[model samples]
Target chain A: MLHHTLKISLVAAACGLAFATTANAEEVTTERHQAEITTVAEGLNFPWGLAFLPNGDALITEKSGTLRRVGTDGVISTPISGVPEVVYKSQGGLLDVALDPNFAENEYVYLSYSEADPAGGPGNSTAVARGKLVGNNLQEVEVIFRGAPKYESGAHFGSRLVFSPEGYLFVTLGDRYSAMDDAQTLDNHHGKVVRIWPDGSVPEDNPFVGQDDALPEIWSYGHRNVQGAAIHPDTGKLWTVEHGPKGGDEINIPEAGANYGWPVATYGVDYDGSIISDKTHVEGTVQPHYYWVPSIATSNMIFYTGSEFPAWQGDLLVGALKGSQVARLDLEGDRVMHEETLFAEAISGRIRDIEQGPDGAIYVITDDRNGQFIRISNADD
Target chain B: MLHHTLKISLVAAACGLAFATTANAEEVTTERHQAEITTVAEGLNFPWGLAFLPNGDALITEKSGTLRRVGTDGVISTPISGVPEVVYKSQGGLLDVALDPNFAENEYVYLSYSEADPAGGPGNSTAVARGKLVGNNLQEVEVIFRGAPKYESGAHFGSRLVFSPEGYLFVTLGDRYSAMDDAQTLDNHHGKVVRIWPDGSVPEDNPFVGQDDALPEIWSYGHRNVQGAAIHPDTGKLWTVEHGPKGGDEINIPEAGANYGWPVATYGVDYDGSIISDKTHVEGTVQPHYYWVPSIATSNMIFYTGSEFPAWQGDLLVGALKGSQVARLDLEGDRVMHEETLFAEAISGRIRDIEQGPDGAIYVITDDRNGQFIRISNADD
Candidate 1:
């Protein structure tokens, strides 16, 4: 691994001639490190989420409500039309659409959206519905998971949907801005990523399985919005990312039933430009593993274990909305050695989804009306 | 002044959306504050220096030795010829170009460049020369000041030319990557902005006017390619910006005979990514008024005293290169309270110059081959 990393870094160094002088023999300051950028692909619209099919083809969801297939060849197929109606407001619309781990056999695709219900909008819940892709059309769409006791507001929907390798699905839902009390309640599913079996049955090993006051499916709580999720390549642990209002955008490895802090301890501030709560750590809520000082408006995360960029293996890949780039985090064991910008200025598009392909290459999709599905690889040249 | 400022802030508050229930209510953190960009102009090549002509028109210089004029009406005229030939390569070429403060009456324009001698490229040097514009052509070009011994390196030409309100022309020179010693030598003019009279004669009031070890025209020493220069509107201070190799892009309010720390105590490192030294406070070299941590590759600067944005009056406007925007710093007296991104992603160009026109409107010129000149006014809904 060391030799492969050095080889790839040498190749990268050759192209980054501008940085030859930047690799000082002395200690590197925050500004002195050099990172290289190469164009991967172009043309994507507010692509909000992605899921890898077993065959390596990826499904991408546009916030404007279109499910498209990004084949391994990097071509964007026509929209597959089983997506539900999305409000698509300030922070609403169709969000976090993922594919089942057994997509090749089961063909079940999962999606989360702000469900428009009669009761205000916690009526706006992170609805996890599954369907089969029947030749560019969804066949037999079923609402697999839904949060209870709707409230108002479409502001934040922690709609990222992911399935653990153990065959259980996790659905992240936001506080819906109606109340923070719902986060502590077990009967309600707000502000948590509820863990359940494929048939929407509560997991027997859930944190609060027999607790009468708590919802049996609640895996974690007090999440602002979980936009990015991926399994750790080596550890197989579930990692997630949440957006803090003004400053915090946290990356966490959550323990089951742990309460992640929101509306309380956050690096972010209120939109009125005031301190959110003068704290970023509450005793009961689990802390994030790592956080960004200035929010990158995070979404879509994956850990690199592909063979294409051997140096990048085991690193984390995160999509940033405000950063308008893909962040490649280099880790030396557990400590973050340094962070590099991978598809930053080169892509010039919001990367909403990233998935390692079966062929050891990587695919990314853009989010927005004029987005595209792009593939990233080593330059053939 | 406090009451007036409060009044304007109150008005701004009226238009600003209040903090939602979740807003932190404290001022936004410095990192999360983003600048709003307004494209004042576009279409030009490496537009480096800007001088608001007496009639409110702007004289913008392209690094290709073209002196283009941006009229008050927002029209870009054909090249105002008669600029001297420059060795246009990595860091040389038609560098800092500015006009006399009395340009309306004198028709005199000043230009600086690293011209190629017969031996090789005379390293970056400030050769203050004047040219008179007669219709489409410049007539009777004369050399005002020239470096004694030419350098052959094609870099570090601090060419910004600005005259104080009292008519002392301040010229910035660069230390062609050799070190601070070159700038310290009396015979060499590599890293000094020589201050002189209109006729290029040494001013008796200069700090080293009669010193045997000092150059008569030396105003300040040890600047590393000062790129931006603007006289403080109220204080009449000569402020300069010099590019630091890797990190230190300094904003210096220069004083006579001061050593402004180059090769010593730099906020930046060598271009090759090596740490040069780690000292920010040296006894002799003056400190930067302000410095950028993660450099934006800064360019020209200005102070806004316009009527349209009364609250923004007397604020410093620094052009950001790598950030591709302009920053407006809010000041509490001389202290920077906070900064607002005045021109961010909106003006899709590198800001080369910023000048407050005679009409009290602000104007900017973009850099690069296809740069444009833009005029800024109150945004009309």
Candidate 2:
């Protein structure tokens, strides 16, 4: 068990008392800092994902199947047209958007949405598509990748997208509600992270490419519902955060072909207080870097590499939906040293996504019908 | 929409750097203070309610139908023998425990549990019972009140118990999952706070005592699952916290005959993102004293008047199950002035109940199979 010996100092600014520093070695001291919050955009319909374009504008995806562009002057554009039709059901819809790595040359953008099956069944699947940005509309759009064996449930569509330094695109997928058993199988894309080339082709060196009965696009498997994914700038590794059933939210540095346990070896029980699995560890499954008991309902993540906040450089920032705050995790190598909740009292809504602006400011989008885009910067500035 | 202008101060204790007090009048400033945590008891099965006895010992109720005694020296006694048979299903079991107002002479102990229906149907209800505590067993246990129209679902049993200053017992009941519409109706006790005499009789002065259609014991109606309740030490008014559907956990001072809207004027949407009610206010409904937009999953509550924390006198302390911390609300005459999370980094599980001990210290019980009873005191002592 991990024990936290927290000592907080309360000083009255008016008293001007000379305080003594307690020399307790195991004590962790956290200095509170304030940030100036500026509203960037308002009246958004549950903005889900945000990505910075090369031209300093941002593309924001609303869960209600609308994509809008926000200019540098905090002006929101009208909903972009020519996007693919999405199943805008519960926890579905236009999920994540990302700019192509060669966006400056190719003018391409990628999107992940809950796709209604062509057979017109009740089932829906997570599908990734790419398009050329032509003014306010996407042109020449084409589906890149689609999850297999679509299910009928509208919950747990883990559709966050991140680009690796090696230029391959990584897409996180959920266990599709009642299909958690598929997470342990190699035949389906449910509850798996897939890495693919921009044109929807699996790379030759993919981890499960040659394995019998395994999907060639699978990078890592057995995730429950990964909503956050970011590349560690120094390590060039992918760090992801996933929501657990009832309790156990986890953060993991998913390695190639690693089996991150879900129903087989979870730290969480079922939602109805029944045991999903009695074990927290298994022989071949990988343990998480950090797991939160009594889940924070983690959303999106980013690794800070900005100059505006020197003290927070290289720290991992996770947006918490249930806790309704931005969690700043200070890491000592792979282990988390301290965790602090930022903008908790200031932001009243669920934090859906977080991004670093080009000018080194922190931008966050809230999840609500009247959600707002907020920017936070050093108050001293 | 509410806006928060928060400014936090960071002071280096060793060097008293002549801090400038920024005079932002609307800015809320919160100072972090740590407490010394001492484990009072451990290895209890999801301990729910805690009450300090006159002899300085503590009595705790576990949700799995066992009640135990903790001595002043932190030794836990074996389970007391005579607890009524409780339905230990999802979110149901032996719940809140309290002492009679005249415990010295009467030696009566009050308990709230999910009572299985007498007809042996697939249904149960929240029932209150009273008995004399004799050594290790409850003598002559008798049912005092049982909620009508027992429902099969165990999702929301809202069984917190509080005694009014006038010596009437107040019991909270839930909408019982599929019975939310009953919250708006007074014909049943599905979603209401009921005031009654100790011996299963409705108080004659109850709000709906003489009404033909309404239940005579109903004090207030239109509430969801109310998990917390306490009386204001100064005003003697009842205050409660209820879990909302998706967002909008609310704190309300429920007045007699007042409708605290649940399924009608909620700030929350349904679990599938469907609207429960778009209006946050209705003509005859009362607004919440305060609300959490993205809910903290509030549980038990208390109004502190303890001398151990002089600055916190008359404030409301709420145990947050989802946030895994205690929320201290500094109140200025019923309106919340400031809110701060306490023991967030120290307590690692869901806080189920909180109480002020006879010695003025704070005691909390965690909700888990391996739950713990933790006592918090001033670190300076």
| lDDT of candidate 1 over B1-381, digit per residue (tens) | 001111111111211322111111111112423212233344567877777766666777778777766654445667777778777777777766677788778888888776766356534455777888776577788878876567667667777788899999988888877644586566677778789887788888898888886778888887777878888877888988878778778777788888887767677777786877766657877767667655677777777887864556777888877766777764434444334565464456777777776766666777767776655555311
Candidate 2 per-residue lDDT over residues A1-381, each given as its tens digit: 112333334322222322121211111122223466666666678899999987778899999888988776556777898788999999999999999888999989999999998898888999999999989999999999999977898988898999999999999999997899889998998899999999999999989999999999999998999999999988889999999897778888899899999879876778897888867678889877777656788999999888777667878999999867888876646545346667666667899999998888788899998777777776432
Please report, as a residue range, the 10-residue window in candidate 2 chain A with the lowest summed lDDT: A19-28
Clashing pairs in 2: none
Candidate chain B TM-scores, in order: 0.83, 0.90
Report how far residue A72 has shifted in candidate 2, in Å. Answer: 2.2
TM per model?
0.48, 0.49
- Candidate by candidate, in order, the iRMS in Å equals 11.7, 17.2
Candidate 1, A16-68: lDDT as tens digits: 22211111111111232222222222244577777677667677777777777
DockQ of each: 0.04, 0.01
Go through the candidates in order and give each one's C-alpha lDDT: 0.68, 0.81
TM-score of 2: 0.49
What fraction of the true interface does each of the listed models get right, in terms of native contacts kept?
A: 0.07, 0.00
